[model samples]
Target: MRINVLQHTPNEGPGMIEDWANAHGHPMVTYHPYQFGHLPNADETDMLVILGGPMSPNDAQPWIKQERTLIQTLRSRAVPMFGACFGAQQISKTLGYEVTKAPAKEVGWAPVYRQSTVIPGIPAELTVLHWHEEMFEVPTAAQLLFASERVTNQGFVLDHRIVGLQFHLEPRANNVREMVVNDYPYIQGSQLNQTAADILTMPVLAANQRALFHILDYITADN
Candidate 1:
């Protein structure tokens, strides 16, 4: 299978998703949408994964508009799409949904209450990584997959093909550290903000990342 990943920033590249793609011998292509502009043929890809960023989905940036258009096209075709954080907001917004500030910001690993009991192997609840200040409303027909204290719409599965997750299923220790050092300003003034020291000092996010792969494999299975 072919996978096209849209990277929004230099540091926020696809994390464990790269491992899955490479291990399975899936052809991987990346588009720095901010640099190359809104990829004209996004829907032509077999699977689309949009990474997170500091920018809002409503940002006035030129590529933002292009991405929005691309997202709309992808949705119309029901192409398998996976979005994280701001990418999730973009997906929800393009699909006639809304994105807004959450009541509180969750910056550390938190438990996700899985409402979709159909997910196999994993427990009904799990601790997932969190990093977004904004949240997205599930598309009207999408099913709720999980929820956290700060956001009721932590995840929504669409047509069993597209998925929007508020948390980072792609997180690794290094990415968490880089985010802490660079994106610290966003959390510094906020109340539930956890430092990179707080997250990196912990034991096991990679295991959780592996679990994330399993969940996604279940969602985007070709068979």
Candidate 2:
């Protein structure tokens, strides 16, 4: 299977998702449209992974608009897609749902309670990294998968193939460290924010990798 990733920033590249793809022997490609101003063709994408960024989906930038169009095109084709943070919001917005400011900027590690068992092997509750100021509403007819105290729309699974997660489950230790160093300003004012030292020292949970791989496997599996 061919896996295509839309990475918004150099620091937010696919972490464990790459690991999962390599271990399974699935060929993968990552596109940085934010820099290159181009997206993968829909026909070539068997599975799509949209990684997070500091930008909002609502931005009027040309690349953002193009990304949304590509997302809509892929959805119409029923391609398997997994989006995180801004990527999630892009999917929601392209589906005609609202992407608005969240009640608060949720940062650092927090527990998200599972609302459905659509994806097997996912724990009822899991603590994951959050670093978004905007959230997407679950698309119509989609099942909400998880929720947290700070954000009600922690995740949603649509059509059994599309998954949108507001948190960072695919981030490895180095990924988290880079995010902390580059995007540390977003963590300062929020009550849920964790200090740089704490975030850097936070232990990497094995369950997070398990949950992420489960979702990836389920979405990309043949229906």
Candidate 3:
């Protein structure tokens, strides 16, 4: 499968998702619009993977607008898509849902509770990496998949093909370290934010990776 990755920034790349793709012998083509200033056409992509970034979808930046337009076209084509954090917010906004600041910021490892049993292989609760202050409402056409203490719309699935996750299930230790180094300012004051030491010490990577694989298999499976 040709997985097209939409990387928003240098720090937040595809993380373990790339590793998973490589291990499965799937070729991944990445588009760095933050540096390249352009996006790939939807017809050239088999599956779309949108990575997390620090930017909010509500911003008026030119690249953000371009991404929104591309996401709209991909949605219309029913392209299988997976989004994380900021990417999720983009999908929600494109689907006519409001993306707004959350009551509190979630910036560390936290438990996400499953709201539905439609998707297989995911447990009822799993601790995933989070680092966003903004949240998106579940679109009307989608089914809510997960929720957390601070965010009601942690994850959703649309048409059994498109998936959006508000948390970072793809991040491994290296990815977390990069994020911590790049966005260190947000890792303080808030009770939900964990220290770099604590986050690095967590043994949740294996579990999270397993869940991510299940999600990938589910989305890529033929109905």
Candidate 4:
């Protein structure tokens, strides 16, 4: 499969998703729109993966608008998609849902309860990384998959092919360290924030990685 990745920033790359693709021998291409302003054509993309970023989906930027349009086109083509954090919000917004400010900011490790078992091997509850202040509503056609205490729409699955996750399940230890170094300001002065030292010490990395790979396998499995 030819997987096309949309990376918004240099720091927020595909993390373990890249690992999975490489291990499975799937050819992957990435576009750094933040620097190059280029997007891939849908005809050449068998699957799409949009990584997270600091920007909101509602931002009045040319690249953001073009990304949304590309998302819509991919959806219409029934191309499998997986979105994380800001990427999830972009999917929600493209489906005519609102990506608004979350009632509270969620940063660091948090528990997300699985609301539906549409995807096999996902447990009822799991701890994952949260680093966004914005939340998106589930689209009408999607089934709610997970929810956290602070965020009701933590994840959703559309047509059993497209998945959106608000949390960072793909972040490995080094990824988290880079995020901490680059986006440290987001952790300051927030009541729900966790220190860099504490976040790095969390023992949930293995569990998160397992869940991420399970979801990826489930989504890309050939029926």
Model 1: which residue pairs collide?
Answer: none
The lDDT per prediction is 0.78, 0.91, 0.86, 0.88
Q: Lowest lDDT 10-mer window, candidate 2?
A: 189-198
- lDDT tens digits, residues 182-217, model 3? 887888865585787777777655878888888888
Displacement of the residue 221 alpha carbon in candidate 3, Å: 1.1
TM-score of 3: 0.95
TM-score versus the correct structure, for each prediction: 0.91, 0.98, 0.95, 0.96
- Ranked by lDDT, the better of candidates 1 and 4 is 4
Maximum-TM-score candidate: 2
Question: Who wins the lDDT comparison?
Answer: 2
For candidate 1, write residues 1-223 as lDDT tens digits: 6788889877777888888888888888888878767574864587888889888887898888778788888777767788988888899988777788887777776788877865565466677767777899898888888888767899888886788889887866677777767776666644456666676676555556666676678767872
Q: Rank the candidates by lDDT, best first.
A: 2, 4, 3, 1
Q: How many backbone clashes does candidate 3 have?
A: 0
lDDT of 2 by residue, 1-223 (tens): 7899999988898999999999999899999999999999888898999999989888888999998888889888889999999889999999999999998888888899999999999999998998888899899889999999978998999998899999999999999999999988888976585798878888779999999999998988783
Candidate 3 minimal-lDDT segment of 10 residues: 189-198
Stretches of candidate 1 exceeding 4 Å from the true structure: none
